[model samples]
Target: MCIAVFLWQAHPLYPLFLLRNRDEYPSRPTEPVAWWDNGEILGGRDGLAGGTWLACSRSGKIAFVTNVAEVGKVPEPKSRGDLPVRFLESKKNPTEFAEEVVMEAHQYNGFNLILVDLSSKSMIYVTNRPKDEKALVSEVPPGIHVLSTASLDTPWPKAVRLRTNFEKFLEKHGSGELPAEEMADKLMTDATKADKTMLPGIYSVEFEHSLSSIFVEANTDQGRYGTRSISAVSVKTSGEVAFYEKYLEEESWIEHTASYVMEQTGTG
Candidate 1:
């Protein structure tokens, strides 16, 4: 996912509210949110890598991955998508799992991963970006946070706007049982409401228009690039989970919805 804003324990009624936008070439193949045959995990699948950028286990575990934007970084053999899938498959607490991943983080391209354990109301964020001070397991503080094709909370224009808008969304709609459609609209915006002078620094000239907006669409010589999918997830304290997704197919966004009750397998 390119841009994501997750509210952990920020709402009184909902413990988790996650909104993310995955950007890629329009031709890239992907499947909308759905449970695998085993019916334990739920999220859209990356057809090319057979992994997922974001997913939630029935036990209230959540994982999210985002690429680090930089130049001349060597690509790793392991796909970043595997990070989320692997976390969902493991039973380790977020701290243990994040620390273990840091040991082998060099094996993958630069990435930022968020692992959450709802049973214990804990979250861990880890990244392998050389620019960061050092790799370590850090707890995700309560309240609003943003992640994009950069370090976590990097304050990229889109990230800042989304975070601000998300807070306003919650404040206007109230913290209780949020309107998923309104939440989805908060992410569907194409407005690039940022200072023009800061554009070149935030994004390359070619990708400025595309990457500046919360919802992107930049057609350049490189390829037809834009936001491919928008997903909104709300997990209630009572274990009622609601997931809504819209995938850009051709020229329109096809919508899909799913509801699952989180089964407390065990405490993290």
Candidate 2:
């Protein structure tokens, strides 16, 4: 599972500041954060699916997704990872794209997707889950929030921990440029697991507990699996954006940063 905490339209200098942890089997082939071959998108790619869990476009659009934690569900026909890619490549605004997604939400597995268009100052949260209910599409209110394997800010143990710590960090930094690397090391790397009773119970307590931490490291029959990378993205009001990632490759850890100024579309 993956987890992320974001401060949106709540900071003075940076309108959107986010930190994400990508957890998967270590053996899975993946490409670290970089500009895609098309040169318009930036983020890590799932080598097997050719899609990303999180990515941003040159035009100031950003999208990311997290899988819903559940059991006994058959796989869907489409890949959830494609959701983010489709949003980034679309000309439609966040609400429009989310509306489109709702039409085909049944084609994919359970997922929570966040779509953002800095130009429009719009951020929409879309989820196709609870199987019995219709897909949900709604605009995200401005504030600090968390998204994990459940609904947006569901108050899961890890989500609460991340939000609390992130609030403290913001208070201490006080409008200054955030230290992305330092924050990643101190906050994202936390391995604290929740108590058995605290688990969401969608899966077995043992399995869910294994993924309870902000950073996950679990060994199962599938082999070694856990958080393989941590990403920090900060978008400044000045149009500058910084994308940073610390990822694991061949048993070694590496880091990279990509910075660029967003294209100024007067509407933003």
Candidate 3:
């Protein structure tokens, strides 16, 4: 399972956002995100890689994609990450954003993608894994959205315990003043401490408690800010293996986190 959250923040500002908890297991060769050899991220793979679960650019655009591998579905290529990234670079609104992918899905394999653009103050979700192209704009009364799976929000009996309080946390809250480390810790522990429903797959060697939590502010100087992360993996503990999180440098990760912040804060 792969998941990510974006948070917003203040800065030189192209609508900044922080990306926390972007963890995933890729196909062995890994899906590529751009044109290689040319130094462009156009969706290629390095042996079934994952972890590009969420990303943002200085342009105030955030995007993430997850593979829904099924037997009957078309064979996924080793270079599907490009689809999400491409969507990020394109589109101006949630509606246009969602429609483009549905219309052009033949260019890649099947997957679910969420795109957030602060420039237009909009968000959209698209998936081609089903028989039809499914897309939706972010809206109220939708509750916590769970993608790729049958249900949204915690589906397990144990996780169901914390739903009520967590929903309140997401609703009543605005930008946080908590320190980065503290917030991250809270995001990771808050779910478990209150109950088991903070996140769907919060416990596993593949999933660790390392990522503390992810927080983002939706309204800012440019209406975007974000921080913290809830990413954990056993491979990083082994020392021999290297696990890479998205947006390590440049203007990339900043936009990613700010996005989550925007989603949380909304355009208002």
Q: Pick the candidate with the highest TM-score.
A: 2
- TM-score between model 1 and native: 0.92
Question: Taking the tens digit of each residue's C-alpha lDDT, what string does model 3 give over 1-268?
Answer: 3333333322122222221343332113333233334332222233334335554544445566765433344455445566555665664555676776667665555566777655555556666654333333332122334332222232433223324333344445443322333333444233332223443453442222222122222223333222222431111111111112332122234211111122232322
* Residue 263 miss distance in model 2 (angstroms): 0.8
Comparing 1 with 3 on TM-score, the higher-scoring candidate is 1
lDDT, candidates in the order shown = 0.81, 0.90, 0.38
Candidate 3 or 2, higher lDDT: 2
Deviation (Å) of 200 in candidate 1:
7.0
RMSD of each: 2.2, 1.7, 12.8
**TM per model?**
0.92, 0.96, 0.48
Query: Which pairs of residues collide in candidate 2?
Result: 119-268
Ranking by TM-score: 2, 1, 3
lDDT for residue 228 in candidate 2, whole number 0-100: 96
Ranking by lDDT: 2, 1, 3
lDDT of 1 by residue, 1-268 (tens): 2788888877787778888888888888888899987999999999899999889999899998988776655565588899898889998989988978988888888788999989989899988883457545688888889988777788777888888888877878785577876777756555564565566354465556457788877787878887898888888888888888988888887988899888973331
- Ten residues in a row with the worst lDDT in model 1? 200-209
